[model samples]
Target: MFAVGFGANHFIPLLQVYREGMASSEASLTAMVGVYAAGLIPALLYFGRLSDQIGRKSVLMPGLWVALVGTLILALGAFSQEWPLYLGRIIIGVSVGMGMACGAAWIKQLSTDDPVAGPRRATVAVSAGFGLGPLISGVIAEFAPAPDFLPYVIHAAVTLCALWWLRAAPETQEGRGVGKRKIVPPVVFTAAYLLAIVAWAPWTFGAPTTAFVTNPSQIGIDSAFPTLVQGLLAFLTMFSSLFIQPVVAKLLANGPRWLALAALGLTTTAAGLGVAVAAALTGSVWLMLITAPVLGTAYGIFMVAGLAETERFADDGELGALVGIFYSLTYLGFFVPFLISMLVTGAENVFGMDPTQAYVGVLAVGVVVCLASIWPVSKAAGYGGRS
Candidate 1:
């Protein structure tokens, strides 16, 4: 929850800055918001497996402290210049990478020996965190007096409380108890890793859409409406994860990877179509609002399916490293679209398209990617039917 909240609070503010502060030509402002993912990939590569050797708590606690500092840096930077935002975001990327790698493992360790429950709990925690983070931040930023300072201050407090809660949580791993494990070099490419990468595009593209549609200038939508839509989207995504994850796990328990991949493809394609249609009918925020939940559900399904594939293919000893790789790729998707929007803004002098058109284009591309990949992903996962 803390990790999710941290991301939500910090991530949206950066987007708000891009929309409000910097000129459209300065795509760097938007790009900077996601550049942290670049730093995260390296950190995940280098330190991902260390948690498996040491204990989850040992790594997670320190990560939280770093995140707290990052929040402070971000808050301070908001008052100063944009460089602090970049620096703070990088720190946050590292912190979140560490937390995801270790935190998921910790949740799994704490679950009763049910293999089903372990992954389900991890899924729930992640979804809940992601949902809560942005929802709370959006609400606070929309409604609260000190939009910039208050959000991070609240986040810092939340992180402190999470740190306290973590102290009581039991450690998941005992180090090899011998000398430390040698650090493994980064694995840049693998078939499964590549699949995870392709699977992440729609998810990341969906993120900025939430912010864009909600922006008052771009869409002329109500300030509170976007936040409300985002909260509903978050809830649908999280709620689906809570229920659908275990079900997907059960179906794929013996490795129905192809079927799961196909489901992901279909659902994502449908969601994308919905977004495109919504864009065509831009006058109706009501219609666009309806699609938000569907998109969220599709995202949830894709996440569960992707994680299962990662888990199925990863070597037991390299679980943390493999998961970290998966996460890095996932966040890579997060960075690319923002970068694209920034670059486009620079070349074109402005994002001339209204919020609706921008999102429709994004969702259309996402749908096409998922549809095109379906056959390949299914073949790779070795599923027999569309089922």
Candidate 2:
């Protein structure tokens, strides 16, 4: 599970480096980031059901092997042309899709009847892995011998260890019948459940995901230190997830869950405004640092709470299917960056605003979405209290 996330993220700090190395356009670099979803979404949709039918180990082992291959492909790209990089991202995405679906379920099965413990453990592992991957990669790339080549080499070694460790883990799905499991969106959910999902939804499309990779230059950061900056941002995000989630979970347990989400949404909106202001004020990078706390806390709470709410509403028969759908929807945020980039470019041309303003302008749309979610949040709170 950890390897799944680590492999997916280890390349982010290298995006700018790759761009300069390959003389690639921003559009192509953006495509490489967005292309991850291209493979991940479909693999998640299929493997979620497939894992239920076969077994966790059956899905996980193969996924690990595929991810190893993807890591190698990415390493090869440091010496080759651009295509291998994008292709590597896609293959890594596919492996993540499978690992998330099967690995979470497997963890749940091993949790000895503690529902909360299972998903919580899996979420933390993934979040930590995702956070640490870029941090490790960036440090190595910045100080180590083979900037592009060595990071992947280290990850390749980690991947092998994870693959070997899986051999002794027990399989959960023994003798389960294979049946047709289609991803049908839930037509009905209690108001609280709906709010929990909606409140967290914007985290996917919001700034935290994009700023580190795309907007670093707008904050007056130099090209030579992008790896350090990216690594710092990744750590902020990961640390926030690790530290804030339990606090938010405790708050939700004590009070209205919907209110917690509402607060998170407002924090995110404030962070977006901060980004705009930082850019306007001569790109004050320190002020711009607000993106991490707001986005990270919101993402952490939303994900953990949203999964809990979804599980509350889901039927036992379709647990795997529901989780798959939930993940797919969450990941849909990956597309938001590409779509917003297009709009930002257009707005820049039409209104003559700078990249920072354009970035914030798009974020305004997300703010509206966050505010509009308050109604559902209210409903979710009411429902959670009663049931």
Candidate 3:
């Protein structure tokens, strides 16, 4: 529920910004979508550890409230000037950053006995909520009379409802004999290999694809398609986690971490290359439809692998802090490209290429980065046997 609210609020207003007044050429559209992620990175960096010290519920409730306020700001932003969009995005980013770290940790704690089930459920909840948000928002925006106001109004209501539901949910972390600890932020490593996978796989396969689907020349594609595609990709990617996770958990669950890591790296690299090929050759909407699932599955594998690796490295006491660090890096992978796009408005200038093609170029870079990272990641994970 928190995930849904966060995801919905993140993208809907950005879409509206494009719809209302922003020129497609300005890359404001991409920046608007990207800024939420920008906010997420910092929150994950600084505040993610807070959940560890306090409690999951303590962090989560306040985060949701912040999200609600952000949504309200977004709603009001639609009426006021353009700057509200940035403000709302920043606020929503903070909410999501805080929510994602705490929420995932909370779910993990609830299902603690079963490691596979716990993480699987946590991943699904986050992914599904993210997917659903755009689907609902897109439908409402496309069909509803007052597109902008209604979608956000509905989002705010849903957020409140989630907040109410959470009031009854149990806290995963109990107040401990543990004394008040200093708020120590986790150190962030680039996780070059992991980051490569993220840049190539999730960014290329997941993020830019949304923009591709929105390209005008792409047959049967539009802004709505991007939103819908993003939703679908999120759902499928997370859903794969539900099934494959258990199998992986059993095989290398704790047995051979390097093998599991390598497999993920290879699969993600392949998927990125596949999408790049599909984009280059067919340029068909049907190809994109097919690529979506392939890429999404790859994304799921990468996410699970990354999280598992984080768990493998973390001490039990510092799990929450590590999770926060991991997520902050992940969000960084998610947003930096959109900021780059905003800087390079060349998408508007290209004659033969559509906005989607520009997106493809961005994705291709990610793919290349991923491919290059495999050897380094293998080294980092101590997969000398495989290498």
State the lDDT of candidate 3 residue by residue for 278-354, as single tens digits: 65455564565555455545545555555565555554455566666666655554454455454224654764556
- Candidate 2 lDDT at 178 equals 52
| Global lDDT scores for all candidate models | 0.57, 0.69, 0.56
Residue by residue across 149-180, what tens digits does model 2's lDDT show? 99999889989999999999999886786576
Error in Å for residue 81 of model 3? 3.8
TM-score between candidate 2 and the true structure: 0.89
Q: Which candidate is the best by TM-score?
A: 2
TM-score list, all predictions: 0.80, 0.89, 0.79
Worst 10 residues of 2 by lDDT: 378-387
Candidate order by TM-score, highest to lowest?
A: 2, 1, 3
Give the Cα error of residue 185 in candidate 3, in Å: 6.1
Candidate 1 structure quality by residue, lDDT tens digits, 169-256: 8775775442344444233255544554444444533433333333222233444455444444444444444556656566656644
Candidates sorted on lDDT, descending:
2, 1, 3
